[model samples]
Target: MDDKEMLFNSGILTEEREGAILPPEELWKNKKGGLVVVECPQRIPCNPCATSCPTGAIRPFSDINDTPSVDHSKCTGCTLCVASCPGLACFVIDLTFSDDLALYKLPYEMLPLPVKGEKVLCLDREGKCIAEGTVENITQPRKDRTYVIHVSAPKNLVREFRAIRVVK
Candidate 1:
């Protein structure tokens, strides 16, 4: 099978694969303030996420090929894993960023990237619009090709929204 088919059928980013990669809601609630959820399911020989973690919080004790499992207690929300991940599957969600707003950090590699303070359409895992989110921050180091976008959304949609699109 072709790579696209493989990816869409059962790869790490597939809907079926989300359950295997995403942590439970209880875990997120318990962690509350700072934690990362790496939705990486299919293990096809990659470890950039683990390698870029400065705190060694992204499965520091596991094998290179092992899917990243965030040690929430140890994670500092550094976001290195999000930018370094080859598949752009890594994400950092801060549920306690505010009383009614949550922060979502995602890897964006699109043209005319949204700037901080820009309003964008928040999307779910399947790319469906769920709500409107504000672009709180955009961090793109010269050395990194992937841009990290920090978006603020309603607390209720924290788990439902996974991506964003340009306002236009």
Candidate 2:
């Protein structure tokens, strides 16, 4: 099956879909604080990601059903869109955190939120644990109840790391 077909059959994003939405190579390679990565490939009627952006990094959609497009240059990586997105497709990756580690700000809505400095099992897009990560921080600027979990894991796993499970 084609990448798009596989994505529809299973919720997991194919490499092709992921590559299409990624920021430019130069921006990904050099940006410091963080960069928003929108994984919403389907042209669904969603605009919260674009509207919630404080820096207008996520450009206004020409059509309501159009997929989000980011002007990486304008993105401050504020992560406001992370909680606003209903599909949970938004993530902020900070590669400059350390030489060996990268920080990921992921949307978490599950019960019993993980605390700061807690150890968590870093899971991939498939929800499989691939590595252990440390919870650097947790922020909820709005009372929407969606918490943004800041997880720091090995820099090499930045692309694979997505969600976290509190280590028991």
* TM-score of every candidate relative to the true structure: 0.80, 0.94
Instruction: Please give the range of 10 consecutive residues that has the lowest summed lDDT in model 1.
Output: 10-19
Residue range 7-66, candidate 1, lDDT tens digits: 758542544455555555666655654467787665667998888888777776366678
Which candidate has the top score in TM-score? Answer: 2
Best by lDDT: 2
TM-score of 1: 0.80
lDDT score, residue 51, model 2? 86
Question: How does model 1 fare in lDDT?
Answer: 0.76
lDDT of each: 0.76, 0.87
> Tens digit of lDDT per residue, candidate 2, span 13-132?
977677777777688766787899889878888899998898889999889999888899998778899888989899999888888888999999987988888999999999999999
